[model samples]
Target: MNQHILNVKRRTSLVTVFTLILSVQLGFIAYSGELKSRVPPDQLQEAQSLKNPYSVTKEFVDKGRILYEGRAFCSVCHGRDGQGLPVGPDYDSSSQPLPTNFTDGAWQTARSDGEIFWILKNGSHGTDMAAFMPQYVSEKEAWQLVTYLRSFQGA
Candidate 1:
C-alpha cells in the first residue's frame, strides 16, 4: 500500500510540472499571435514618417551599444542578445506586453526604423518599456541604438 501511494504521488507531481510548462508556452504563443503596433493611433503616421538621421557605421553602433548596455540598461530586460528575458509568473498579458525579441527576423522586418525611434522617443504605452531619449540618451544616440538593434536581426 505504501509503494502504490508513493508511485501515485510521483505521477501527480510530474503531471503538475508538465501542465505548468505547457501553460507558460501556450501563454507565449497566444501573445505572439496577437502582436500589434505599440504606437498610439494619433502618432502612428508621424512616427512611421520619422527617419534616422545618422548613418549605420561601426562607431554609431558602438555608441548605441554603450547606451543599450550601460545607461539605458536595455539588456536588463531585452537580454544582451536582444532576444528578451523571461517575464515573472505574475506577468499579465492584457496590460503588460512581453519584451520584444529583436532576434526574430519577422519582427525586425515588421518594425520600421522610424517606428523604433518613435518607441524610443515616446515609449510604448501600457508596457514596461519606457522612453529613454532626451533623458537617458539623445536623439542621435537613439538612432544609433536602432542601428545596433538591426544587427540583432536573424541572430
Candidate 2:
C-alpha cells in the first residue's frame, strides 16, 4: 500500500511539472503569437553581449565542419545542413526543442556571437542540449562552429 501510494504521488508530481511547462509555453505563444525561445532572459542578455574572438575564414569554417561532423556529431540531431524543428515527444523520445535552424537569417541575427559560444560552452537548460566543455572541444573549436553555423545564413 505504501509503495502504491508513493508511485501515485510521484506520477502526480511529474504530471504537474509537465502541465506547468506546457502552460507556460502556451501562454508565451498566446501572449505574443511568436515562438518563444527556450533560453532564459538573463542567458539571452549575456549571450547577446558577447563578440566572436576570431575572424571567420575558410580555414576556420573547414575546421569547424570537421568537429561538428566528426567528434561532435552535431549533424545527427541538427541534421547535415543544421536545420531542424522541435519534434515533440510523440516523434522524439526526449521531446526537447528542435535543433536550431542556422539558415534562418532573422533567427541568427537575433542571437549574438557570445550567445552561441555560451550555448556551446554551457549548454541550454530545460532542453536536450549538452554542454561542450573545454575538455571535449577547446574554446577555439567552439568559436569555429559559431562561424560555420553563421555561414548557413543566406545559404
Candidate 3:
C-alpha cells in the first residue's frame, strides 16, 4: 500500500513539472505576438502615406530607391524598373500567377496604399514570394516604397 501511494506521488510531481514548462512556453508566445497576422489599422494607414512627414523635399520614391538597393534587396526579384523578374512569378505571364505589374496604371489606381503595404509586410503565402520584407522597416520607408512603385505605373 505504501509503494502504491509513493508511485502516485511521483506521477503527480512529473505531471506538475510538465505543466509548468508548457505554461512558460505558451506565455512567451503570447508576449511576443508572433501569432498575429496584421499590423494595427491606425499604424497601417500612417505607414501607407506616399509623402515624407519630416521634410517637403524628400519623396517616398527617392527614399524607396535607397531602401530597394540597400536594406530590402527588392531589385533582386523586382528589377530596378519594378517590372518583376522570373526569380518570382511574372506579372504579365499567362502561365504564371501574375505578380503586380508596377507599370500598370489601372491596377495601381485601384489599390490603396494600405493594401500595398499589407502585401509587402505579410507577403502572399503559398507563392514564390516569401515575405521578403520585415516589419522592422520604418513606416517612412514603407511609404517611400509605395511612391517608388507608383513611378513604374504607366511607364
Candidate 4:
C-alpha cells in the first residue's frame, strides 16, 4: 500500500512538472508573437538554403533603404521604424495578416535571409505583400533590402 501511494505521488509530481513546462512554453509562444514562415513547404528547403551574395555594408543597407522608402514603398505599411503600421480600414483582416514588425528580435531570429529574399521575389502567400522583384527592384536590390531589414533587429 505504501509503495502504491508513493508511485501515485511520483506520477502526480511528474504530471505537475510537465504541465508547468507546457504552460511556460505556451506563454512564451504567445508573448513572442512568433511568426511562421511564409514560404510554402514545397519550396522551403531551397528557399532556406539561399544565401545573400552581396556583402552586408552601409552602402548596401543605404541602397536598400532607398528602395524600401521610395520605389518599394515598404515604409507605407511596415512603417519607417520597421515596427509595422496598421492597415487601412478597407483591409480585409479575415483574408490577410498584418504587416510584420521587423524590430521583433524573436521574429528576426526565427526567419532566414532566404525566406526574406523569397518573400521579395515571390511575395508572402495569403498576405498583401506583393512581389517587388523583377517589377520594382532587381535581385541585387532585393538582397540589399534583406540586409537593410536586419538593421531593424532590436530596434
Candidate 5:
C-alpha cells in the first residue's frame, strides 16, 4: 500500500513539473510577441497612425459596401453583419484565429481607426485573413470600410 502511494505521489510531481514547463513556454511565446505577429512595441503604433489620403464619408461607406460584398467577398467569410462565420476560426482567436467580429464593443473600443485600416491593408499572418483586401479596395475604400465596421460595434 505504501509503495502504491509513493508511485502516485511521484506521478503527481511529474505532472506538476510538466505543467510548469508548458506554462512557461506558452508565456514566453506570448511575451516574445511571436503569437501577435508584428514588430515589438511602438512600431506597430507608428505604422497604424499613417493616415489615408482618401476621405471617410457615407459615400465611401457605400463604395466600401460594394467592394466588401462584391469584389472583396468579405461577407462570405465574415458574414453580412460582421458577426463572423463558424466556417473560419474567429479572426481574433489566439489559435487558428478567424476573422474579427466587428460587433464586439470592447474590441472596437480598444482598436483605433488607423490600426484597423492597417490590418485591413496588411492582413494578419497568423490567421486566414489575407492582404488581398487592399489589392481590391482603394485606400479610400478601405477607410470607408473602417467607418462601416465601427457601426458594427453597437450592433
Candidate 6:
C-alpha cells in the first residue's frame, strides 16, 4: 500500500478502537445501578415497621435539613424542599421516573417513617440515591432526615 494509505488505515484503526472503548465505558456506567429497588418485600416491610426514636422536633428537623443539603448531598437531586428533582438517567440521579415528590400529601401519608429510614439506609435500587450508610451518614442523622421529611410533608 502507498505510505499515505497505510497512515490513513492506522488512523482509522485507532479511531475504531477508541470508539469501542468509549461505548463500553458508557454502557458499564449506565448499567452499574440499573435496578429500581433491591429491598425485598419482607425486608422492606420490616424496615417499614421500624420507628425513629428521636421525636420530630424543630431542632432535629433543622439538623436534618443541614445534613440533607450539605453532608448527605440529598438536596441536589431531592431538592432543598425534599421533593424529587428531574435528572437524567445518568450517574448520580435519583432514577426518579418522576421527582419523588415528598410534597404530595397523599404520598407522604402513605409511606411510613420506618420505610423512609430504610430507603435512606439501604438506598433505592436503580436510583442515583446511593445508600447513605452509617459511615457516610450516621444512623441518628438518617433518622433525623426522615423526621424532617415527614414533618415537611404539608409544606
Tens-digit lDDT track of model 4 for 28-147: 876654476788889999999999988888898999999888989999999999999977799886566788899988889989999999999999866789999989899999998999
- Per-residue alpha-carbon lDDT of model 1 for 11-57, expressed as tens digits? 99999999999999999977665455678778888888988876777
Estimate the TM-score for candidate 4.
0.75
RMSD of each: 10.1, 10.1, 12.5, 4.9, 5.8, 10.9
Show model 4 residue runs off by greater than 4 Å.
Answer: 1-34, 87-94
* lDDT against the true structure, each candidate: 0.87, 0.78, 0.65, 0.90, 0.73, 0.76
Q: Model 6: runs farther than 4 Å from truth?
A: 1-39, 87-96
lDDT of 6 by residue, 12-97 (tens): 99999999999999888665433323466769768777988877788988898889889888878778876777655574444344
TM-score for each model: 0.74, 0.69, 0.53, 0.75, 0.66, 0.65
Q: Candidates 1 and 3: which is better by TM-score? A: 1
Query: Model 1, which residues run further than 4 Å from truth?
Result: 1-34
Residue 113 of model 5 has an lDDT of 76
By lDDT, the better pick of 2 and 5 is 2
Question: Which has the greatest lDDT?
Answer: 4
In candidate 3, stretches whose alpha carbon ends up further than 4 angstroms from where it belongs are 1-59, 86-98, 132-136
Residue 145, model 4: Cα distance from true site in angstroms: 0.4
Of candidates 4 and 3, the better by TM-score: 4
In candidate 2, residue 73 scores what lDDT? Answer: 74
Model 2 is weakest, by summed lDDT over 10 consecutive residues, at 30-39
> For model 3, what is the alpha-carbon lDDT of residue 124?
57
Model 2, 75-94: lDDT tens per residue? 87787787864565576643
